[model samples]
Target: MEQRPGKREERKVTESGHRRTAVAESGSPATGARIAGLGAYRPQTVVSNEQAAADAGVAPEWIAQRVGIHERRRATGSETVVGMAVEAAREALDAAGKDANDVDVVILATCSLPTAMPNGAARVAAGLGCRAAAGFDLNAACAGFNHALAVADGLVRSAVARNVLVVGAERMTDWVSAHDRDTGPIFADGAAAALVVPAIRPGIFPVAWGGDGERADLIRIRADTGRMEMAGREVFAWAVTALTPVIRAACERAGFEPGELKGFVPHQANLRIVKALGAAVGAAGSVTATDVTHTGNTCGASVPLALHALRQRGELTAGDPVLLLGFGAGLSYAAQVVLSP
Candidate 1:
């Protein structure tokens, strides 16, 4: 039989006054870490293919065939990154039956923050009333959510935090130029959040993360010009050839068979990339998320947003096994197996 998560275990306090136990160390704690709930915030304005195509100087059919995006959300006034994150976090906390005071840490993942001085997570914490929480930001581009999930899992396992709110929020439209065909129509805006807390059994599996700094130039934000640029074909090829192994390695670490997973949630990059990666990993018959079709590529927000969308669409159930793959700019990527909440 497969090793199940949420096996009940008694907690023990160490001399350092930290909680520790077999379940917490290896396998369960009222205080073992698991994903408790998920939530998302899609901007109100919907920009259709026609509008985007006009801006990119491409036909609506061309946009559909190329990226498979039909419409994407565009944030307008008052829909700032931190604001969206807080909204999603609130819904997650409500779904988890947790109070803002319960959260010990807040991690916001994104690369589109308008300014760098005041970390967005701090504002998110304050907005959500997590008065005593530690807050910070992470920018792994499209891989941000997966990276934040790994960090939250570890923090909960180590008893450094009882509840951690992991959020992926992005305003990619803010970074792209309207006339730039390469990125203008391909990126959008959105936010999603997950509530992670101690549990009796393990819910989050170990993460397989790696990056290629040498190829970082494949996608980058020009500091001097402050515009986003990309070689779409090169990035697509790299993703097709490179990310399959990361998926397999994550399954190996979690002891999962290809067909065992109930769902496959990858970063919502594009329909082509989503289909290719899913096929490469043999994700047939699974409810693979193609959120990019409607949400576009929300960068850091993609994976978690896709996850929340899947749950809303009833394509997943509680305690279902899911594989999450995140790959993006920085030539960075991460993959992991998780139990759907």
Candidate 2:
């Protein structure tokens, strides 16, 4: 994805109408996100793929083979996305040697909020004692985190906020149909939060985006009505066709190539989509890193969950260029190329 002077990168069909390449070093400047702070919270209950399948009348092997999910975490009766997000946000702030009071802005990225009033951001601010801070919600469904990053980037560009906290949390288990097999093994409950602040010039930078709303039904969860509507085959095909361009556009805008990326953090939607995306973008080997197989899909928390897990494995370092991509409901897609702090 070579840059065309002033143009930013985007994901869609390639210039040549075929999948392109995006390669980067793990600690390079092309893609990176400093773990300045991070945290997460899960319900006391744990649900394995087999358990979900059994309860939903689906074969465990079918779920595993199709989605590459082994298990997912579920919240207890008293837990809420707000609580999990607050806990994770506090942990991230603690890791950064700062408290929520130090946070200037809050971006609560979630698909399922505890309530409809006050927005999730306001509640999170109250919990963290950051009452003076301004916060709000920015949703992109499964790509909520990526969308939040774009929003934060714009805010930083305007110097409106210095220390921003982005939390992707969800209690998806509450929405799943206990008798529906399509969603039982896929959706999970979890939260992952991060603190994004100023870094060296090579830090978090330009991101990219892509989408085709006409196919919004590829993956959807109705509100207080029909259960999840997921076209597995449709989603897999769309991912392969749509994701390549998003990465290419983002990398080119950052003045890099698909082969220059060190690591790729795509939304943990399904193992099948992840693998298909990797293959389509020519990253079938080690260039693509993942955690979806074990964690299942945590809705809005998917990317951050992978980040949290990756950092724990000692897989990240300063100056790394990490490419984050996500696609979900709305038939939307977003990819950001941020430099690690």
Which regions of candidate 1 are displaced past 4 Å? 1-31
Worst 10 residues of 1 by lDDT: 22-31
Q: Pick the candidate with the highest lDDT.
A: 1
Tens-place lDDT digits, model 1, residues 1-341:
22334444455646663344423343433434678999899999999999999999999999999999999999997999999999999999999988886777899999999999799999999999765678999999999999999999998877666688999999988889978989999999999999988765778989999998899999999989899999999999999999989999998888888788889999888999999988877867678899999999999999999999999989999888899999899999999999998
Q: At residue 118, what lDDT does model 2 achieve? A: 81
lDDT of model 2 at residue 63?
84
User: Distance from true position, residue 167, model 1, in Å?
Assistant: 0.3
**Model 2 weakest 10-residue run by lDDT:** 19-28
Best by TM-score: 1
TM-score of 1: 0.91
